[model samples]
Target: MTDIAPPSPSSSAEPAHDRQNLIARQPILDDKRAVFGYELFDRSTAAAAHTAASDAALLFNALSYAGSEALVGRKTVFINCTHESLKGPHLELIHPERVVLKVQTLGEQATPEQIGELLPVFESLRARGFRLAFNQEVLRRAYASWLPQAAYIKLDLLAFKPELAEPLIKFARSYSAAALVAEKVETAEQYERMAALGVRLFQGYWFAQPTVIQAQTIRPSQATIVQLINMVRQQASLTEIEELLKKDPTLSFNLLRFINSSGFGLSCEITSFRHAVMILGLKKLFRWAALLLTTSRNTGSPPAVGQTAVVRGRLMELLAAELLQPEDCDNAFVAGVFSLLDVMLGVSLEQAFESVALPQPVVDAVLHGKGVLAPFLELTRACESADEEAFARCAQALHLSNRQVNWAHLQALAWAENLDQDE
Candidate 1:
């Protein structure tokens, strides 16, 4: 790798269009079956046209808003880069060493003219120490010129015929220095087939799916989470809440630590659970407790998934604050956070909720995706999925403008990032 400095993504001033961006990542593994890196998908920018600005916006948000350390750790991040996006100023914002810019094909049938123009940009990026990745189609004779510049070539298992796999592997190995990556290897059979062909890296759902630990009893921390929720819901007195906190020393410490976190902006330190609860009040305390459940450090689920839940809860609350009662906003927060309890608890949603008491609206939203809080929950999901039509529909149904929704989405992501850091 060359000595070019990583782009200062946080310092870059992004346009208004970039503010609402969110990232989703798929893990990539090496032959030894360890996590090698991740392919970052900019789900928020999914609805936009493939332009340099949009692509740059995605990279900017991944690095700045979601945070590089939290998002990719010390692994490579694969980003799709069009010919135009590769040449854009945004490429200047990324660190080259752990980032692979996958140059997207120009079209279904890219003409020689199109490939010819992008060659120089590819060469320039390569010379600057940026590793280039491409799809298997780049192996065709017409695109042969790009072969030497490639650092990785991905073959989609579902896209190519099984018979052609061997030939493609042979061609890639003999002709280019690029490491071969097998994409969409959704089963053990496909994984073995690709490994037999000397493909060194693999990605798809099969490797990453959560293994549900069925019939497992709840953990002490999780039970505490539920107990706190119930106590807060029943509006327990200060002495009762303090007694509950005293039973779990760790919970008390975490509660104090969280209250004093930078995001809270407390004028003075919150030294005790009672003091913290008094300041936060029941409504805010419940929101904090519900959110704390997702940030449990011991869960099998990825921290990012839990963080996504936190974002959903915060987004729902922020959105609801504009259109609903303060109590309803609290319910919206609960609905959003509890929506992922099944994934977090490794049981069905019904099984997960049996222990906790929730409002009818929150219960309906979490269990049936119906009730007053349902639209807010749906809007939160639409933001995560970048489902533009769903977002518009939900926003319209809730009588919310795009600006309100986008502002809340950005704020929620920023809040989640801060919360992760605090944890």
Candidate 2:
């Protein structure tokens, strides 16, 4: 759960409008078990029927609130759409090649005529370069009009008996040219079975689950990343780090934003990469780089995980500012941001820490849950989650009032939102 700021006493107790958008994504993997794209949906309205309004809201939020890069990055995005939404103006906002629109049926028993009526709509979308995806229902003879337009066909493993999947797979392969995607695949057996049946794409919890690291290891790849890690590992000179930052525009931009972020508690803005490096010094810059890479990496985690970490880091820093020294506040921010490193890196925190050398205080709070900053970290998490009891306990432990915490929480949310907008 991302730590969302609570409303202030002067404001309405109702949640913010954007908070209600609550977007969630599931990774779609290829045969090599690498993430190929994502299936994004509105978690806030998961139980609601698929309607024009719901479809519009999901697309609008994904584009506006979540931002494209933060949501799916460079990966293909699969969005569910109602027949009505298929003709919506919202679909115009997306780049056709990057998005695959999953068309939903009218109901459990939609007629052949009803499905055929949307053929023109489907054709129009394809003409505009948008790819279409359909459920296993499209394999039925009744949905023949819809089959030819399908670029991908999804098979929900849990929707039918195990033996039934193979025949459906065979039937789809024999008749249609669409790529088969096995959905709701929950175990190694399910994934293997789907692969053996010639299914190349998969979506489910089995591959999405974070890897449990039983031993310490470093798996840095890419020349730039390896160089950066090596530089940090060797405690290279400031000049060397600055030269490297100058070579990579993306890293330079991230560095400037990171040091000047509201949570960093800087009195003035940092305008240059060199200035930021000198001000933050070598150690803090390494921490910032670790965070930037962890969140920005294409590690198959949703953009929300990185976004949530930024919020937590800012929230904790703001909360710490009220009671701790400036240095401790800085550490608090790192602790908050790095708390989710395990999930973002697809490894345990123990293994994540083994790869990067973070401050001992941040490590203690995140890894062992024993340190001066541990209670504040707990309080920050409480603000993001719905555990009211834990919230009160942690807040009381820190001797802070609800108003103070709420104010910080709200500020952190706004800060993170602003950062996304800048991006």
Candidate 3:
């Protein structure tokens, strides 16, 4: 995970890992958030607690802030680039959305020829599906040449990199690259400088750091668990799931939106909740709903913890379905979910899985990847969580293709998002 665009790794050994943390402020312009994107900024595959590895992870662990209700569908996220990810897989994760990359970070010192070599890489990545951004202090040679290809450019206005700001800003306007971002702006004066320079995207505490809201722990209340168990037991019919969902107006609304999202690629629109329930089946529906319920905060809880679990669980579960044998799909869901148990509830795995009624093997996989479903499930989970070590390890163990894993994940997200949407 050493910073690649369209992030795809060839080796299973190095672990698909990037440990970056970020504190971003959605630069509000015209009372609207500037197009803030998830910028990938750090790396480490350590599972001992993401924050334990580096301050960057701690800072950026909540990069998913864009995923929460606090910023959902509002700001874009720009993840940093990695070498392996330079030409291919990194772009898709943030497609039809905003993402930023440090193009030169793909190399340290570039010869003119090397810069030329990367031009196609940038071209191909953008074509694959990323709305790209550039972050650099020196916008010379290659970057200057590629500036035309960028969607946005970020200059460190606070540090005032004379070498970078002038040329990048000039070229950005000349090409109509979406907007310029003035990062690290501290004082009112700094913001004013960049703002005057036409750098509308500003990131710094002077504006605001994406605040960390303490997330509420949504225990699968006994009532919720009983309902889930009943749903899976097939006692809850298609009509019943639909009705039960309406009881939670928010869930009903999201499910409908998901059913129609581009992720599903549905030729015919999904118009009814009952129809969606029938298509998904009881097992998957309950697993998904219960998981979603568990992730929703009840009070003054940070949305990140829960939202990440929801996205990660849904992502891994869907991918694992394609890779695992029929018998292990639910096990896959459990594995994907528990992978982040430590982070969300801030507890040991043993404590987290203890409350849920899962098969021993599934529990084993979630806890230590100790069962047959563990590797594949963990592999899918790793990619979704962007945990390169787990993904690389699990992928190598299964001798699976990175391409296959990504395709599976994309299909899964698209599927879940659509299936959950009623409208």
Candidate 2 vs 3: which has more TM-score: 2
RMSD of each: 19.6, 17.2, 19.1
lDDT of 2 by residue, 1-423 (tens): 122121122111112222344677888999998889988876655455556656665654454334344456568889888777788654544458878999865665887677778989989999999999999878878787777899999999898888897899988987888999999999899888889988999998887842221211112222454456567667778778765653333344345444443224356655544577788765555444443333232323125766687788888988899889987886787788778877765768885554443568888999999898899899988998999999999999999999999999999888776643332
In model 1, the worst 10-residue window by lDDT is 210-219
TM-score for all models, in order of appearance:
0.47, 0.47, 0.42
Q: Which lDDT value does model 2 have at 305? A: 64
Clashes counted in candidate 1 amount to: 1
Candidate 3 lDDT, tens digit per residue, 1-423? Answer: 112112122232122122122233344332144444434333233443222113222222232221232323334545544434554321232224434444433455767676667677777776766566666533555446767677766676655564556666776677555567777767887766666666656776677655433322323323433354455565555666654443332343344444443332345545345666665555445444433333333333224544444445555655666567744654455455456656754657675444223456666777776877666655665775757877777777777777877777776556444422422
Tens digit per residue, CA lDDT, model 1, 187-274: 9999999888778899988887422211222222555666787787777898888756644433553455445532243556554456
* Order by lDDT, highest first: 1, 2, 3
The whole-model lDDT of each prediction reads 0.69, 0.68, 0.49
Candidate 2 global lDDT: 0.68
